[model samples]
Target chain A: MSKKNEIIVIGDYTVTQLEKLSEEFQTIFVNKTDDLRSLSAASRKNIKGVAFKGHRPLEFDAASFDLLPELRIISNFGVGYDGIDIQEAIRRGIKITNTPDVLNDDVADVAIGMLIALSRNFLNGVNWIKSGEWGKSGEMALNRTVSGKKAGIVGLGRIGCAIAHRLSGFKMNIHYYSRSEKSSAKDWKFHNDPVSLAEEVDFLFIALVGGQETSQFVSKEV
Target chain B: MSKKNEIIVIGDYTVTQLEKLSEEFQTIFVNKTDDLRSLSAASRKNIKGVAFKGHRPLEFDAASFDLLPELRIISNFGVGYDGIDIQEAIRRGIKITNTPDVLNDDVADVAIGMLIALSRNFLNGVNWIKSGEWGKSGEMALNRTVSGKKAGIVGLGRIGCAIAHRLSGFKMNIHYYSRSEKSSAKDWKFHNDPVSLAEEVDFLFIALVGGQETSQFVSKEV
Candidate 1:
């Protein structure tokens, strides 16, 4: 197949993801922008769509986009597309897409796991058992309780809402601060600002998106 | 205050727990059976109730019960009263109580947290970010999804049921095995045997009570 007919896959993707992508499209695999530049002119020209994976900044500027004149869309593997120059893509009439809500459950699960692990002192308990202290010193001290505690979620977006939903099972009183009030989460207390949200809760979960708008979102004041 | 009028607190209790107990009653604190014997005759006779606080076997045999003739009840601090000789306590006309259902939420929270942590490779992710490998290695490899996977709960009692309830929020298919099927969890699949339950799920959580009856509950076969 001609190089121009292929898709470009950039970043550190898993073997399975890469295999799946390869099965579907004749792909030009590159780890970074430099690798993309290193590819032959024909291979770069043939790239019509870019499957951008990883968390690193892609810097999809005009010059980079111009390298692939046939590029129609830049499909980001993760929800955050801060690395991609959306303004540049828009100016050049290219469509930009991101995998957003697809990771909400996974992200929420991790957040809840971290909260529980921390509050319950799981590591301490494990170490106590492993070090034979459980046998010698007897039962470890009682750790803090997690359920019924107040939890504040910053940025009640897809992942935040999912986390709130799971935490509700723990009987936590949910409080949140977002750009605007989420009507769907009417039961949860809404704080107009991050400071108010933090002040009202025992546990605070930050789930804001990355990029200029959300950088330093959870500052000292918050 | 007479030692005979005090409550006997046996086990490795926290300073806070001991302080709390002391505030309520003149507590005769002892961690082992030998310590109980070390108590003055007057102190032993004054004990009316025993607040047993650790996993160490209390060995409330006939001889020990005879030592505290005024002993009326043995209130165990934890959910499992395995360390207490129930039959001996019954024969001696002494009451035994365990703090049941109080820790269901915490136990369930830990179980769910562990499941999510393992499936999502949370430790690996933390290490990646902590070691500065995230910047060097870019994105980590994709991890297994927690939601939509099958989970098996062994001994569907209080903690097991709580775990199942939380796993349901993750959209996990719940499977369980107990002495008898739990009618309340009709929606969850019941395995007549633990082996069958283990065969059907990706994650298996053992929430059985600690005792001789449940000693080898999760055997090699299961």
Candidate 2:
């Protein structure tokens, strides 16, 4: 019953920082070893927590966890937990954590950049720029204004909320479909159905969390 | 002399929906010309208003205005009006306008996108995606959480405000620098001098109007 917390960071980068936090730490640093079976065979004892990268495909043999009964936490490195089995982890009483906010602005920014580039036909402009279609050149891109464009937000979670807030001043008529009304969300109009949100939105922002609920979304081409 | 108004958009694409407001019978429509030089030449006649692409460079000859005595309103098609000469237009008693509110979401979106792409190394991920690095073997970029990072906003205009609003929920400490304290700004602490703002900011956002005032800002490599 030693209280020194044991953490098997599936990657070493996060643990390097976590180790600096220094609250009596034991970390099993795992970095880019493709075969998890070998690591699982090597590390099936005294594990208290596990942090994993979702990029690589991994599955823990039931026998591995059967031996490591002390494991308590599972921190998914990125925002998604697709790499792990949620129901099994839940049954095992393991708490899962993720990195969410670290990328909100970046993703939001890219979405808008694409919106501007697409609606304004920056692709065409890029062609124009390279071709030296300047002062005496013919017609440029006949682009729609990004300001008054109709926008639909796919999910209204933290990232969705961030996108909506970033879009607040742009004068876009924003439509969103969320699990429930944000009662506090004042600027955007909410819809219960996805099809209805799609009808009016010229620009659609997809921010759905990856899991059983949202895996198939955008499959139909929103 | 008539108080009646007619606007001709001098660009490839015009806001055709703006014509739906014709039911009000206030603003009249002249034909849109995709050619900028021809459009400027046409502005000399009865066309009183013209909108140009603000983000792209436009040719503004004094000779054109020397011909356009009736031109009173010059509206830009996008948010950035760096191309237009405000002083010369003002001297000729021409009022300048831009599609400001429309691009806030778009600009904030790009800014956030750049921040994310830079911070999380999403561009590097893009390199991975482009080079088949994701499917093949490569060193994947792992990022820290965007939450709780120090955020500094350079200006508090509409787009800047939108950026701040979107970032508010991420739980980051917000700091802003403006020429003066914004009357309607909320929650965030303000710093008058950018030196103070830059000293502590981990991520800085540029939202100010481009000019000598904002030029060479964040010039320090630090």
Candidate 3:
């Protein structure tokens, strides 16, 4: 039922990279402003994959996907597949893949940076210098320490391990809660549950795969 | 000169922890306020091994530390050591330690988060929701894919390595710049200068030691 393998890019992206990516797959850039009918009509003509379905929330449910039997896989652009209906995809025997681990450091870095910014008012201090507050007040004032504190990370995986390695330099007692414990890691302590991990740490980090498993994991405990 | 070995906490802290720490090191608490002179005078008299200097920047200049021979070490409470005169302390042979790796995960998270925030307008989107712009608007927009982007880090040390490791999850091409080169790390591409590193990546991170070699490392090129 296939003439040529078709792939769609559903978000805004650099044309340069898009051109390069097109060599591997047939590409279409469909953003918020896209026409679903055109997308559906295109899918009917032997299109096999939707590479960026989760870029925006789904406009079509499982019923719409059933109309086009050509759709075989939905390659998610990011780790969080909240926008996609997992049950619907699973029912249809459609394969779903997320670009995980790839963005771990970026996301983890952003998360930790945000923590520091919030705890010590780092952004406010930077704003002070930019907005001429430093000239007026002489300084932005002192900030909180980032060391000698309990650091807790949830979903200790690749990104979590990387974070723990970095946290080691800070002399923080690292605590983690995962579905399966890494008994191999003898250096850091582990809590039986998320509540215990949250309670033990002064700084709590959420670094787990997001799906049905880890949605609102931190919301309950931390 | 000697009574009981008194420990000093030279900043605002939770008294519960201090009481616990005092049992180990003769704890003393000195509140840092607007008066800098009194802050230094009070801290100078103490012979505490670990001084948790808070709010006010560490008050002693290098010469002033010379007057207090009993002081052993200054354990900084936070990440940025701007308040302490590190060079002067080095000259006097005083052991100055900082909480470095502790905040690495948190700070790296924030750095990447900020990049995403700035790039995607995550805060603006949140602001839109809080400002009641979400429902009123036809569609809500957030930032783009964090994965598969080029990331360049300055100073490939503990924090820098943490940032790189986290970003590695997103499948980004990670590059670094350090004074000396290493041959063992096959994954990380090393650049010789800051300008070269900045030129390569979509996101730029500054995680270097602040001293003679790195004060203005990520200069205007950013």
Fnat (0 to 1) per candidate: 0.74, 0.17, 0.21
List the candidates ranked by TM-score, beginning with the highest.
Answer: 1, 2, 3
Instruction: Tell me model 2's lDDT, rounded to 2 decimals.
Output: 0.67
Model 1 DockQ class: medium
TM-score of 1: 0.86
| Candidate 1 lDDT, A126-179, residue by residue in tens | 678889998887678878888889999998988888998888878889999998
DockQ of each: 0.64, 0.19, 0.17
> CA lDDT of each candidate?
0.83, 0.67, 0.68
lDDT of 3 by residue, A81-172 (tens): 76677888888898889876676555654565465557767557657878997777765666666655789988788888867765664456
Q: TM-score winner among the candidates? A: 1
- Candidate 1 reaches a DockQ of 0.64
Kindly report which residue stretches of model 1 are placed more than 4 angstroms away from their true locations once superposed.
Answer: A1-5, A8-18, A27-48, A54-58, A125-130, B1-5, B26-47, B54-58, B125-132
Over all chains combined, what TM-score does candidate 2 have?
0.61
The reply for model 3, stretches above 4 Å from the true place, is: A1-47, A55-62, A81-93, A130-138, A208-222, B1-222
Report the lDDT tens digits of candidate 2 across residue range B1-222: 555456554444445655543433244343332243454454447766665543444354465465556888777766666666677888888888767676676666555545554566554665677888767775686664565678999888887887787566445678899888986876886999887898888888878887677778766752
True-structure RMSD, every candidate: 3.5, 7.2, 8.3
TM-score of chain B of each: 0.91, 0.70, 0.74
User: How high is each candidate's interface RMSD, in Å?
Assistant: 1.3, 5.0, 5.7
